[model samples]
Target: MENYLNALLTDVMLKEEEIGDICDKACEILLNEPNMVNVPSPVLICGDIHGQYYDLLTIFKINGTPKSRKYIFLGDYVDRGANGLECFCLLLVYKIMYPSNIFLIRGNHESKDLTKIYGFYDEVAKKYGNSRVWRYCCDVFECLINACLVNGRIFCVHGGLSPSLLDIDEINRIYRLNKLPDNHFVNDLMWSDPDELNPGFSKNSRGAGYTFGSEVTKKFLEINNLTMLVRSHQLAFTGYQMHFKEKCAVTVWSAPNYCYRCGNLASVLRVDENDITGKNFLIFKDTPQKPSSVGLPGYFL
Candidate 1:
C-alpha cells in the first residue's frame, strides 16, 4: 500500500481495482467513527481542497506528513478542478493509513447530485470509461464524519450550523444513510455559511442551508460551551476568512488559485491547544501545473 501511495504521490495513476479497494478500506475506517468526531489539539485544520491535486501536494509538502502532525479536512475534496479523482483517492489513502491522525468530514459536494453535475463524475467516467469508480467513492463519502470537536473547545464542520442544532450530540443523532445528506439538519451542517453582518438566520443564496449570523454563532458556542467554530465552504482570496464576534468562526480554504484562475491564496489553521483561539494561519499560493495525465480536459479548464 505504501508503494502504491508513493506512486500516487508522484502522479502515477492507480488501476481501477486499486481505487475500489481504497474506497472500501476508507469506508471501513469511517464507519466506526461517530458523526461528530472528537480530536485532540496541536493539529492542522484544512479546508476546500476542491481537487487541484498539485496544490494539494504543495500544501502537504509545506505542512509535513500526517505521520507527525494531525489534520482535519473540512471537505469539498472533489469537483470544479482537474484531478478530483486523484485528490479523493490520495485523501482516502491517508484515512486508511492513519485513521486516528487524519480527520475528514463531508462537504456539500460529496452528494451524488452535485458530483453528477460537477467535474468529479466526469473525471471518473473519463478515466475508467464507467461510473463504477464514482459510485465507489460516493459510498466512501457517505461514511465521512460530519463534525469534529477539538478538545471540546473548538467545533469543526464543513459548513455552518443548522438552526435546529443545539450541540454536537444532535449531529451524532442524525441517521447516516444518504447519498446527498440533504436531511434538514445535516443540510445546514454541510452547506450553511456564516454572515458577520446578519444577526440571525436568513435564506442562503446557495438555495440550501441558511446564512447564519454572529448572534447565531455566539449562541451556538455558548450553548455548546465551545470557544471556536472552524469551517470552510467559501473562497477567501487571502486564504482564510474569520467571522462572528470574539473571532469565534473561521473559514480555511486550501485550494489556492481556485479553479486554476481565481488568483487567490489558500491556507490551513493550526491549533496548538484546546482553546483554539490561537491564530496560526499557514498561508500559501498555488503550485505549478499537474501532470498531463491529470491535467484538465480543456472543458473543465
Candidate 2:
C-alpha cells in the first residue's frame, strides 16, 4: 500500500490490476465506517477537487501530506476534469494507506447514472477500453460515508440540510452499502445546496434535493447540538461562503479555476481548537499543468 501511494503521488500510473486491488481495499475500509464518519479535530476539510490533478497536488504541496495532516474530503471526487481517473485512483490509494488520517464523503457524482452522464464513465472507457474500472469505482463509491463529525461539534457533509432530516443522527438510518441512490435521504445529503435568498426549504434548480435557507440551517444546527455545518457541493467564487450570520454554515470550494475557466478561487477549511472561530480557510489558485482536453468541456460541473 505504501509503495502504491508513493507511486501515485509521484505520477506513476498504476496498472489496471493494481487499481482494482486498491479499490477493493478501499471499499473494505469504507464499509466498516459508519454512515456519519467520525473525524478528529485539527483536520483540514477539503471541498470538491473535480479532478484538477495538478491543483490537487498543490494542496498537498502547501500543506504536508496525509502523514503530516488530517483531511475530510467532502466528495465529488471524479468528474469534469482531465485527470478524474487519476484523481480518484490516487485518493483510493491514500485511503487504503492511511485509513485513520483521511476521510471521504459521498457526493452527487459518485453514482453510476451520473458518471455516465458526466464524464467518468466515458473517461474510464477511454482510458481502459472498457467500463470494468468504472464499475469498480462505483462499487467503492457505494461504501463511502454520507457525512462526518469533527470533534463531536462540527457537522460536515457533502451537501446541505435535507427537508426530511430534523436530526442529523437520522443519517445513520439510511442504508447505502452497495445500493443504488433509490432513496431520498442519500439524494438530499449528496445533492442538496444552500440558497441565501430563500427563508425556508425550496425546490432546487438542480432537479434534486432542497435548497435550504438560513432558518433551515439554524434549526438543523440547534437540533443536532452542532456549532457549524460544513458542506461542499456548489461553486464559491471566492473559495468559501458563509451563511446565517457567517457562522451557522459554510460552503468550501476547493477546485481552483473551476474547469480552468471560471476564474474561481479554491480553499480548504482548517478546523483547529486554537483558532478564534475554531476554523480557518486556506485558499489557493490553480497551478500550471500540462494541457489536455479530457476536462476542458467541464462547464456542466
Clashes of each: 0, 0
> Candidate 1 lDDT, tens digit per residue, 137-229?
989888988999998788998988888787668778866874344447788899999988888999899999989988888888898888888
Q: What is the Å distance of residue 200 in model 2 from its true position?
A: 1.0
TM-score for each model: 0.94, 0.93
For each candidate, the alpha-carbon lDDT, in order, equals 0.86, 0.83
Off by over 4 Å in 1: 178-183, 291-301
Give every collision pair in model 2: none
The TM-score obtained by model 1 is: 0.94
